[model samples]
Target chain A: MGGKVTCTLGEVKNRADFIVYWGGNPAECHPRHFTKYTLMQKSPFLPRGRKDRTMVLVDIRETKSAKASNIFLQVRPGKDFELITLLRAMIKDQPISEAQVAETGLTIEQLQDFVSRMKAAKYGVFFFGMGLSMTRGKHMNSAALLTLAAEMNAFTKFVAMPMRGHGNVTGADVIMRWQTGYPFGISFNRGYPRYNPGEFSTVDVLVRGDTDCAFIIGADPGATMPQPAIDHLAKVPTIVLDPHVTHTSKLARVHITTAPAGISAPGTAYRMDEIPLPLRPALKSPYPSDEEVVRRIKEALLEKPDWMGERPQMLQNQI
Target chain B: MDLKVIDHATCTFCGCVCDDIQLHADDERIHQAKKACVLGKAWFLNHTAERKYPDALIDGKEATVDEAIAAAAEHLYQADMPLVYGMSNTTCEAQRECVEMADHLGGLLDSHTSL
Candidate 1:
């Protein structure tokens, strides 16, 4: 269940029949996405592009993408899992209770239509965001979506991917997976990758006051994280690397200024659509790049062999 | 000694991060950029506006870069617990340094959500 595989967005596009944008507004967040890659872009199989593909937008509000979508399912706030379950029932041709429809604020007709579209599609893809993962459900919401996708595969092809916001968040996940066999919420305290979201995740670690040291990369939880996480962050030994001063930088113990990604540093960032794009530095900065720092840490880890170890069996056992 | 032109680069102003761009430079200054969106254009043309020198607050006063770095290092070394944040706008290189320092000091670190 835990392994690494390399594939292209083109392959995913070829296999997908329906693309569902859930809890993410690609239009506002990724302006050129539809024009460059997802819907309107020209592809070998989808010669007609947007016309040849089915686009559905699932959000809490009616967004610009929803306005342009062929199907828009506006689920109530924090009701994503419930809606997914109801849709699952619909896919199975089972009757859904009116109470479930009322709870989700989606009419029976709307639910029926969404389920019909999902069933009719030859292949389907769900691109979800933090809106679903950061809310009441967190990882369980992701698990539910993945489970739904897995179930859908019995009738038609379906897959799900998180709409990672950072430029290299996917890269971080990829790196961690390659090195530790876990994506995130990784622990080195026991000398291996110990995967526990609530226990080892950045927020959990900070909230519980379990960590004494924190090394942050291309991410900022100060401005975005919940108040509890922020409060916890205020009490930690923090180091910041950024071009501009931010809330986190203001609280940093050691602030190292550097150039912006894709502007002053060259690296690879996974786009919202899970496409790997090269970031080219247009200018130079006095400080080193994140890659250099990670390389140094890796060298240090190599020198201190005890700090690095084989993947812990606990994660597999939990699974 | 002479000016140079580069092609196929990404713009860093906004989330778009448009990669198709050309840069024209002469000696020490970038004269013009082509095929850049409005945000990218402003970013390239206003390169001089970007800050190079670093400053620090010593007793709530602006101090030299060295003073700031020293103060920051001292603060980190002395603090029982600290939080390091913001890397969305910076290069990964700086992020690496910040991360190392956090690990050494056992601090909390994070970056911008939009970057």
Candidate 2:
């Protein structure tokens, strides 16, 4: 994620002249993203601020995010690949068949205008969302977006990044990378690190019935995971560590309540753009902090080093 | 005491971590979260919201943190195959501890943050 993510939220907020909200409804999902970072911002580089910058909203529907755009490109759903490819081709002065142009629902002139605007900007930032990642072409759609950005580089400076959500989700990825040398789905089960995303990922592993028992910390998988995964979590003996009462905890063998990190415990959390910021504790919490509970668990485990050997059948406890 | 404004207060609610928040705190309770979005307001005010607190539980019975942890450790250690999942909302230090624990237990580790 670090290697791929090129620009910071600050950079996007201040420097970008041609901003694109592609397949992402920042108005709804991010709320403050457009207002604080992209459009409507009175940036230093943009002396006239919102007037100095131009935004393009490219989505399948007429989203609220589109209302803020100078030009809204409502490409057909799942036609992102086609639209992006056409933009890239048009940038390179390649001619396309009229039939192919008709399939995209965008006239060649509109695409050429979009490309020319992109080429003319001093600095551009392309912000994409789950619409691009979770769509039909998936990574290919992302590749096309990236390629378009790269092509724009010949005419002007440009960078693209996913409009990541869930706050510290970016933090989780950063910490995981520094710790395991992998972004996600890492296992040290064989006493060595193994990295595999689809195989070792939580839902995949749970759905495959590979995990026998689970210790869930700070998340509610039962409510959010796929049905099979939820069923597995419920059936198997599990532990949930959270401050809030969640669907997963309700079905757990042991529910250890912990204080919310930023609100009740002092810690460092990352912003959406991977900026590490100190999280100040605003209130006193009755529940133990995650750090304390985990330390206690480690202490308990150290005290019972041979416990696993004593009950070797625990490994085979799962069906 | 009168309502006081604490400027440069970071609202940990949303990822923005808007440090510009001026928390109006009366005592330790928040009176209002100024310079915040609705999401940030709800999150900051959530601290004062009434809620139940259960220290720990083991097998549907209330227990001390020690008792529950012991049970949990025992259950985890005995499992031939186990999973250590979800560290999204936790501190990096805590997440490191979890990774170490997972390695020691010879179990797998994953997160809710992983999509």
* Top candidate (lDDT): 2
- Give per-residue CA lDDT, model 1, range B3-114, as digits (tens): 6676876664544455677887653445677877555666676653245535333443545545544555555445454444444444434444544443443434433431
Model 1, A13-49: lDDT tens digits are 5555578888888776655555654677656777777
DockQ metric, candidate 2: 0.51
What tens-digit string does per-residue lDDT give for candidate 2 at A1-319?
Answer: 5556367888988899999888888777777777788877876688888898999988889988887889998788888898888788888888887777778777877787898888889999898888887688877888788878876778789999877665466666776677666666877676555788678889898999988889998777887888999999888889889888689888899998887887667777777677788776666677888978887887787787553344322221221
List per-model TM-scores for chain B. 0.77, 0.78
Candidate 2: stretches off by over 4 Å = A306-319, B1-4, B49-51
DockQ of each: 0.21, 0.51
Interface RMSD of 1: 5.8
i-RMS for every candidate (Å) is 5.8, 3.8
